[model samples]
Target: MAQQATPVRTARLGRTLGQEPTAVSGAVLLLPGGQEVSGRRPSSLLANASVRALGRRLARAGRGEGLAAHVVHYRYRGWNGGDAHLARDATWAVEEVLRRYGDVPVCLAGLDMGGRAALRAGGHEAVNSVVAIAPWLPEDDVAASPEPVKQLAGRQVLIVHGTNDARTDPELSFRFAERAKKANREVCRFEVHADGHGLRQYRDEVTALAADFMMGTLFGRAFARPVRDALAAPPPLGLRMPLAAGFGASLSW
Candidate 1:
């Protein structure tokens, strides 16, 4: 008889960027992007570099508040359709955080495919917020298998997308934000003009916005006016809020 493959198991799948905090008020899990469909090959460093940088920035911004940041190392490198392997890994990371820290709030932050995972995993009880940067939402038959929105209730959700990204349609994320906002008033989205899938053109501004949102949601810091206005405004206006140049430099906190 042929033996089945053994499942991989570990104490943790997260790599802390800095020294692990002895005590944390809150935590952020940074998830990196991957392919649409592929085998269970391990995720690469190239894919994780950007999110790591974002994690470092967030750690610095929330250092005084005792925020612990970790970059989640996914077991597989693809979305793999309904399997949703990456999302499961994100959920596991949340559990790991709870095990180590004991019931502290967590923010799920991801880019590209990682963003989709963050959204999918936001329903976890310990998760207080989610920051999806350049999220990849599949353009399938919406009526048949639309991405879920009901899971986001009572959580602060922020979706950031680049208008010019060709890899993933920005419109799809807007549609998602619209649906999420209907179910949960705290859902908001920001458009990064003239940027691409990687969002490198306005990296500073995007990172700043994400940091602000994460800190505000996890540590109770006041959000910037734009973030507050975006969440409070009605429909189209709030869902399609524009992110301006030098917005990061203007942030007070």
Candidate 2:
């Protein structure tokens, strides 16, 4: 054999949640929404090819902001996929991002089913940020998310959806807000007009919220007056503002 070459190993720059290394303050995990649809992977939420392209566009935006955001797409193994798998995958992705980055913040965002997954994953210790747009309720027509879910929270959340979105209905956003209130989680929600499920109304909000949410989660929230409201009573909107550590949002059209 000729002279053998050694593989080069790099240090992580971003935050770590699992065993992988992520780039510094640059990488974000974008999990596109995939519902139970007809596909080679039926259990996966089918956000469609168009949505996939949108993810790429978001990734570019992230890069433009000096953040290295990448989109991750995968199919769950069973019927009507649940957040359990989404959570697992997201956690793994976070570690990978951390291994690459070292100490920078890591964020996760999604639309529809993916939105729900982002919340589920953000609740874990691994995630430092999250964005949920028109998330699907765990139960049929449920207004607020369950108590356990509401409690397991962290990072900032930017919930944006159309007021007239026929797929999930506007009332659902209100319900989500209520649950966030109960959980005493900080959040921010926006109700865009005529945005519908495709989110055609406010494109700029997407980029702005993503950056703002990350900035707040990474550097804001600590020096502010502490949150003292009991978990039993309703949560104030400010506590659930669009910014803050482990924050959340409720955007409706």
Candidate 3:
């Protein structure tokens, strides 16, 4: 008889930066984007470099307030459809945060497919907020299933997308935000004008906005006026709020 093959175990890892994990009051788990379908190859370091940089920036910005940041290194390099591997890895990261930091609140921040994963994993008890940047959403089709919004009911959710993002449809994210807002009034979205999926044009502004939201949600810092206004406003106004220039400089943080 031929010997049976044994499954290989892949470990999902997280790189923690800024403030000692044990001493931090809050945490943020950063997830990076990946392909739609691929095998169990380890996530690429080059692909996750931007997210790691962002994590460092966030850690530095929030260091005064005892915030620690982590970048999740996924076991796989793709979404893989119904397997939802990335989402599950994000949840695992949240659980890991809880294990290391006790009861501190956590924010899930992701780009592209990671953004979708962050939103999908927002329901974890330790996660208090979610930030999705240029999240990849599926087009409406006979077999396509809508993303779940019920898990986001009690979480503060923010979705930021570039109007000119050719890679991921901004309209799809807007529609997802609409459904999510109906389920949870705290949900809102911001549009980066003339930007692309990378959001490189207004990187500082985007980073500032994310920092502001995370601080507000995790440390009780008051949100900037535009953020507060967007959260309070209804429908198109809130969901389609434009990210203004010099917005990052305007913040007091």
TM-score of each model, paired residue for residue? 0.94, 0.64, 0.94
After superposition, candidate 3 runs with Cα above 4 Å error: 1-7
Per residue, candidate 2 scores C-alpha lDDT tens digits across 91-193 of 6777776676666676677777667667777765656667677766554346743524452365555566677778865566556666664454555565566
Local distance difference test scores for all models: 0.89, 0.53, 0.88
Q: After superposition, how far is residue 241 of candidate 1 from its true place, in Å?
A: 0.7
lDDT for residue 14 in candidate 2, whole number 0-100:
24
The model with the greater lDDT, 1 or 2, is 1
Whichever of 2 and 3 has more TM-score, that candidate is 3
How much is the lDDT of residue 53 in candidate 2?
47
For candidate 1, lDDT tens digit of each residue in 4-89?
99987442455666766667989999988988887756556788889998998898888878888998887778889898988999
Each candidate's clash count: 0, 41, 0
Give the winner by TM-score: 1 or 2.
1
